[model samples]
Every structure is written in structure tokens, then in C-alpha cells.
Target: MLFILAAIVLTAHAASYGVDIAESISTSSIKCLRDLGFNSFFIFRAWRSLGSFDPNAKSINENALAAGFSAKHIDAYFYPCFSCGDPAGQVKSFWNQVTSKKLKFERLWFDIEGTWSSSKSSNRKFFESLTNEAAAIGIKSGIYASYYNWEDIVGLDYKFSRAGSWPIWYPHYDGKKTFSDFKSFGGWTSPYMKQYNGDMTACSHDVDYNYRP
Candidate 1:
């Protein structure tokens, strides 16, 4: 009986998985992840400041709260489309919206994959500025990108080592499902989050599976 009880307790405290969604997913899809035992979510908010914000962010947040799941916000404004106007302008616009709306997330993720910003120096400056803005508002920030993108955008050199200090969320779908499969890369000894699979399903809706360590 004691052994059986221990098994039950261990199962109750097992680590939970989560998913990342965007405008492509409806508010109703939030339930899909919850039903799959996901305890957290990261919903895409915007591609750029000038681009449209996700119309379903609030609904997803509300639904996640109702389902007893934590929901966070994500944005792809780091290297926005070149045609989206000035990068600095978009950063300011994004920061303004983030402050004015009172998005109650403890942390935010900045997507760092795009061809608009070519120079390494420009990209590094943009990242520093984004981190500063988030710090001013008392919100922690993380970088979300694949290992390839990390090496390509920031490199593994001493100068780019600054990125490893921040929280790293690496996405790699290499058919290795275990968290142990995610090894350190690009100067980061350990990643905060690892997107191990991109073909996960919940309630018939497709979502990416992420492991939070």
C-alpha cells in the first residue's frame, strides 16, 4: 500500500508540457492544450509594431485562466519585415502598446529570426534596446529561436556571448523527444525552454510542444 501511494504522489507532481499559439489558433483552441495536460502557454501577440496584434490574445488569456493554466505573451518585433518601416520606430510602438495595455504577463519572448536586419551589429543593438525596455517595466525577457538562428544571428563568439546571459528558448525538432536531448549551444550552457517537437496535437488542433526546465 505504501508503494502504491508513493506512485500516486509522484504522478501528481509530474512535470507538465505546454504549447505555443498565435493568431492562427482560435480562442477555443486554448482548451485544446489544457485538455492535453498543458499547464502553460505562450501566445504570439504581434509580428511587428506596425503589424496587427493577435486579435485572440485576450480571449486565450481569459480561457487559459479559466482552465487554470498560465499564459504568456510573445512578439516577433526584433527583426521585423524591412518594409514595415523603421525598426526603431516599430520598437517604440511595440513598447508603447505593451505598457498601455497592461498585459499581465510576468515575462515576454522576443522572436529573433528574419532577413530584414542583416548586420550583426544592428541586431545586437536592437536586442539590447528591447531588453532595456522590458527591464524598465519590471518584466523579464527571453530569446526564442532555433540553434541555427542563434548561431547565425548572434554567433558563438565572445562578442555575442552577451545573449547567453539572458533566458534562452531554443526550438529544435530533431526527433529527439526527451528533454535530455536538448544540449547547450551558442554559448549557452543551459536553455530555459526547449521546443522538442512541432507536430503535437491537442483536441485535433496542431500545436508545438515545449519543455520548460
Candidate 2:
């Protein structure tokens, strides 16, 4: 029992414990994880791009609250398409959804992949405006991308290039780069450099790591 307790403690700090995932997540699983001391979770396919939107966010929060999670215990966000629309439309849509949602959340995550930002000036303008939009309504926002992606697709040193808004630290196990420890991953691709991502549906008993970018 003592060993088990120690192991749990050790694993808890390694990453955000969005470890194991299931086909469909249940309240019991979420509750059990919270009881185990996990305060964060990643929601899989938590979007409504096409058909009707799922009430998963609110429902999950409901269950989590029943299990003992306050608003402080949960953080939720989604995968956003950087090139979804023109700059203005993108910012409008992002905040529109956030403002519409009544669900209690801590942060908004924007995943920038496969899209090209026009220029540093344009990127900074849009990003800063987006951050200001979220903050104006009392919400926190973040961006997910690796250093390589930033340098290649998106230019670094934008006005909003700081780590808090756009943390660049990534996960690498090949021993080539030794900055970030492996953490929660959102997709199936291995070697993710994120502290927490929504890879699966259910929580797990495994360990996860967290770090700054």
C-alpha cells in the first residue's frame, strides 16, 4: 500500500494525468481519477464542426463536480484550425463559441497545424487580438505547437510569442533534444511535445509529465 501510494504521487507530477483513454468516458472513471488526485483532463473529439454538438463538456463537468471537482479542478479546450477562415472570421468564430458556452472552463487551446501564417506582423496582430478578446470576457487562452512548427510554418518572435500564450517546449524521447518530458498527447502520432492532450476518452492509471515551453 505504501509503495502504491508513492507510485501514484510520482506519476501524478510526471504529466497532466490524461493518461489512459477509453472509447467513451464515464463519470465513474472521471470521478475515480479525481479521487486519485488528478485535477486536469483532456476531452477527446470535443468539437461540433459538422453535425450537432455534443453536450459532453457540460455533462462531463457535471459528473466531475458531483465527484468533487470545483471550477478550479477542470480545464477544457479544443483543436482549432488556424486557417479555418480569414483572420477576422477566425477570431470571431473562436470567441463566439467560447462566449456562447455556459460550461465552466479554465482555458481555451488553439492547435495550429498544417496552416501557414502570412507574415509575422499579421500573425501577431491576430494573436494579440484573440488573446485580448478572450481576456476581455474573463477567459484564458493558449496555443499548441512545437518549435519546429513555429520556425517552419509559423514565424517566431511574433508580438504574442511569449511562452504563456505560445509555449514552444516540445516532447522528445529520441535523446536528440532534452528539453521537454513526454506528457499528454491529443492524437495518435507518437513523440508529442505537449504537457496534456486529449488522446483518448477515459482516464488511466499511468503516469504523465508536465513542463514549460
121-189, model 2: which lDDT tens digit per residue? 555565555555555655565555555555554454332433444333243334232243443222212
RMSD of each: 3.7, 7.2
Which residue pairs clash in candidate 2? 14-208, 14-209, 15-208, 15-209, 22-202, 171-193
Error of 1 at 86 (Å): 4.6
* Per-residue C-alpha lDDT of model 1 across residues 79-142, encoded as one tens digit per residue: 3544454545555666576556644454567776665366766666665655566566555666
TM-score of candidate 1 relative to the true fold: 0.75
lDDT of each: 0.59, 0.47
Estimate the TM-score of every prediction. 0.75, 0.56
Q: How accurate is candidate 2 locally (lDDT)?
A: 0.47
lDDT of 1: 0.59
Measured with C-alpha atoms, the lDDT of residue 169 in candidate 1 is 77
